[model samples]
Target: MRGKYTIKEINRIPELLKKGKEYKITYDKDKKYTFIGCGSSYNLGLITTKMLNKNGYKSNVISGGEVIVFDKVPQTDIGIFISRTGESTETVKAVENFKKRKIKTIGITCTADTTLTKVCDETYIFEFANEESVVMTGSFVYILNFLLNGIKKIDIIKDAETVLSKIKEQIDTIDLKKYNHYVFLGYEEEYGISKEGALKIQEMAIQNVEYHEPLEYRHGPKSILNEHTLVVINSKDTKKEAKLAEELKNMEAEVILIGKGKDIDIPYNNGYETPLRMILPQYLGYKKALIEGYDPDQPRNLTKSVILD
Candidate 1:
């Protein structure tokens, strides 16, 4: 039962997504949106904001800590708070700030009867995507796919099982012990996915991880590349990104590209397929944890929710 929850949750993603399609989630085209959350939820907000902005909506993201401590709530017509448990203190408090200003609020969580649902103007709960593990695996992809579907119908759900199988095969062939440092690189929405990828390795495998925009790696970050580093690039299929991957490979770093015609080879369906790309890191992190003798279900010094007093 060490990694039971993580594996179960990851395998449940396709089922959760299929159910998400029938969920009555709503979005407003006329309103500007601000998303607030912490950790995995915050990283999700980043991907959501990028997707919304790219699809002709005005949206931005901020961490719940910023809203509570620095009062960094931006002026926007709508505020969306995301929390897996819906009871994270900073996230609930941030929603309260939005409520005080009379801004329309939305809560996206995997739990229904929680503090977030009680405060927000609207709440969308996907309890099926909820996890028993401290680290988020399926719920992250499920919620992100939910938001992406709200913006535009995501057809990738049909291919999720196939994608997961392929990723697992690729991961099984790689020797996890060979790499000590993990780096994830992407651009825009993919950059957020890369950040989440890095977090997954750090949390579950307890390894050194870094994330940067594909080209940004050249700006001093490349100096640290070595034979023991494994770089996962969430590529945009751009020539520059491809060249960078080649350069890193030549520098003796292992590079796995997750875009058209690359290592993972998932079609970049205008970023709608971004959720599928996440399976790579999720499986990698889980496998790496097993290799390192860490429990992926209960990552060290972490919890299911951050309920600060």
Candidate 2:
């Protein structure tokens, strides 16, 4: 438990975000783009894909294993391979699959001088963001911020301090010991972030967690809400999501809303604001793990990268 890299990395997100702009490139709107990765990288791609498609760009995300096992690689002009350590098996292997199709491949990772750099046509390694922990944290923020920088001009680094401060202010008030179940809700990229947020708590806190679109939760998942449920709505600033937050609170479930100053105020700047939405669950997961006497940095049954046999 002496290893506290999770929170340490979480705290560096704002600084890492500043580094993202240096990597921004002009994203061609008409060219079809494909992103591939696993776990948090996949989720990062999911969010970037959402932002891209929503802004008249053609893009899609695929898990690396889907390319290796199911041959599910889609036609694309370029393939972006994501892996934190530059050694995830499926991701590194899947690069050849894209090359075989004559598609240009780009690699993104935190570490340098690894398999991903050698396999891809080019690689963007942010050695500054290389982590000392098993789980990925700041790298997700850095990489997503980098991709978002290409499509949009809003500097997230300017807003990072206020957004993270609000998240910490609200999360500190939460008695994490009282909760056992966590749920994250949103739509589109918010849903992608919800899924990633769920991952943060899942990997670090080792808790029961769920994620769904805000309205979709009522379709079936709401049946499980109890006093121990802590629901976080990555709000769309919609009337329905606001109403849903109230409904869940009435059910005796603690609720945190991250839109328009409800709990953590982040006015959605189109889809660009989605990356900052992750700070809450990241910090919450860290605090939850500490309360449970578990080490957030050293997650059990996990490693920095998944190298398949």
Candidate 3:
């Protein structure tokens, strides 16, 4: 079966991220930062904020609707608005709100000459990372990699092709039809990634997906686990996390751990390897969608961008 733009965009991630390496983005370490967007862009903000905070920079993530509807703009010196199309109404409006507050605002988008560029103080457009597909894929990694690089120099993994090949091999071995529920768990920046992982499967395959912090799963979420459940842990390679994976496996749930020496062992470099880790779910979602006889590109009742009136 021929996969649509979803698979095509997934394949382009390495090239797009490498192309982003040539560009330089300037940021103020002294300024308080606020990141605003919707959906996938909002999730990117979450990961970015966690990274920034962990590195000693003051930053926070807020949904665009919070700023537009609730006037919930946090007090900050700088604001970064993210949108793939750069025309998302709430996101553009959020940038306006930041500008009205006299905050230095930056708009990050994959498309150029967009409404977002007109509203923000500065815009970083990565046109090469733009996707033909509705669901954000390669462009998501590109923008996140670019923003992370701006804070600190990041080494874009050169072996993305090899990593993806391993993911494909792993996906082929799994009986996707056997699982009806999928759960993704992680910590800090990885938590945001887990959310995105769940969203990928939810969007592409229309599966029952959930995301939570690694340790938080035991609080109440693990009770539903059964042989039909597939759990993906975006581990930090800690002993506790590994133990949780082992425990889940013992409970009859299929577990795929993405970290050092796990099922899909991608080297964990203090969450800097997040973009590469995303490949696993992206591919899994696509393959599962095929199994369910759904077109991954054109998910039911969804559009490329959420443009509100």
Candidate 4:
């Protein structure tokens, strides 16, 4: 089951979302929040932080390693640590630093009864979203939806089904060997989605990838655009982003735009729909890995969790 678990996990995103735990924890709208995680979980925090701040909830994001190594935690009323496995060393240990500051602590993970649950003031365990693959996939979307939608009737499952159905044809037909350079573009919360998208390709296909704001690419990064370059734009449904997509296409780089009436039907929805955009890149990564003959189940130099001594 080299690529089997990866495929299975990605396809089961809707099922996992259906099983997500509702947001039962009380929150203080006036309090400041800081989210901590690593890799995909970090990206999740980034997206959530953007959404939270935009919606008038004061929030920021930090990496667990920063707290562990630099002791640099943003002064916040709450520290929300996220880890898929609930046992990431930096995230687990970083809790103490926030606790020392007398900050309220929260933990979010897929596995239950792990160190995170024991250490944080509160823990959210999405046991249904747990996966065997080292790389985070369905669980990422599940947690993101939980934090954002909170078991709301958002119909993310339907959006995901639509994306996966359409993206399969588009991604499967691509010659993965020809595309050596990949770029992801977005703004605001979508930028975090772009980061996660680039990461999916990098982890599965071992490709050189970059992510930037749409206009930022026009700076110096556009110099790398070529026929071998593939660009994915998580559009903000703005004219400027659309124009950038057209410019990149004219430059002969393949472009995928996920916005209203774009390559993918799901609109930016002010970043609420950004969770569905994740499916496209995930499927693309899986296909590219199969093309590269690497087992998507096990990526190079990665483990299900990072447990430092």
Which candidate number maximizes lDDT?
1
Model 1 score (lDDT): 0.90
Shift in Å, residue 36, candidate 3: 0.5
TM-scores for every candidate against the unseen true structure: 0.97, 0.98, 0.97, 0.96
Please report how far candidate 2 places residue 256 from its true position, in Å. Answer: 0.3
Residue 22 of model 4 has an lDDT of: 53
Instruction: Locate the minimum summed-lDDT window of 10 residues in model 3.
Output: 154-163
lDDT of 2 by residue, 1-309 (tens): 444788789898998887666676568977999999999999989999999999999999999999999877798999999999999999999998999989999999888999999999989989999999887887888788788888877787878888888788888988999999999998899999999999999998899999998999999999999999999999888888899999999999999988886778898677788878888888998889888888888888998899978
Error of 4 at 100 (Å): 1.2
Which residue pairs in candidate 3 have backbone atoms (N, alpha carbon, C) closer than 3 angstroms, thus clashing? none
Question: Lowest summed-lDDT stretch of 10 residues in model 4?
Answer: 18-27
lDDT of each: 0.90, 0.89, 0.88, 0.87
Using lDDT as the yardstick, the better of models 2 and 3 is 2
- From the highest lDDT down, the ranking of the candidates is 1, 2, 3, 4
C-alpha lDDT (0 to 100) for residue 2 of candidate 3: 45
Q: Higher-TM-score candidate among 2 and 4? A: 2
Say which prediction, candidate 1 or candidate 2, comes out ahead on lDDT.
1
**Model 3 segments beyond 4 Å from truth?**
none
Q: How many residue pairs clash per model? A: 0, 0, 0, 0
- How large is the C-alpha RMSD of every model relative to the true structure? 1.1, 1.1, 1.2, 1.5
Under the 3 Å rule for N, CA and C atoms, how many clashes does model 4 have? Answer: 0
Badly placed stretches (over 4 Å) of model 4 are 21-26, 150-153
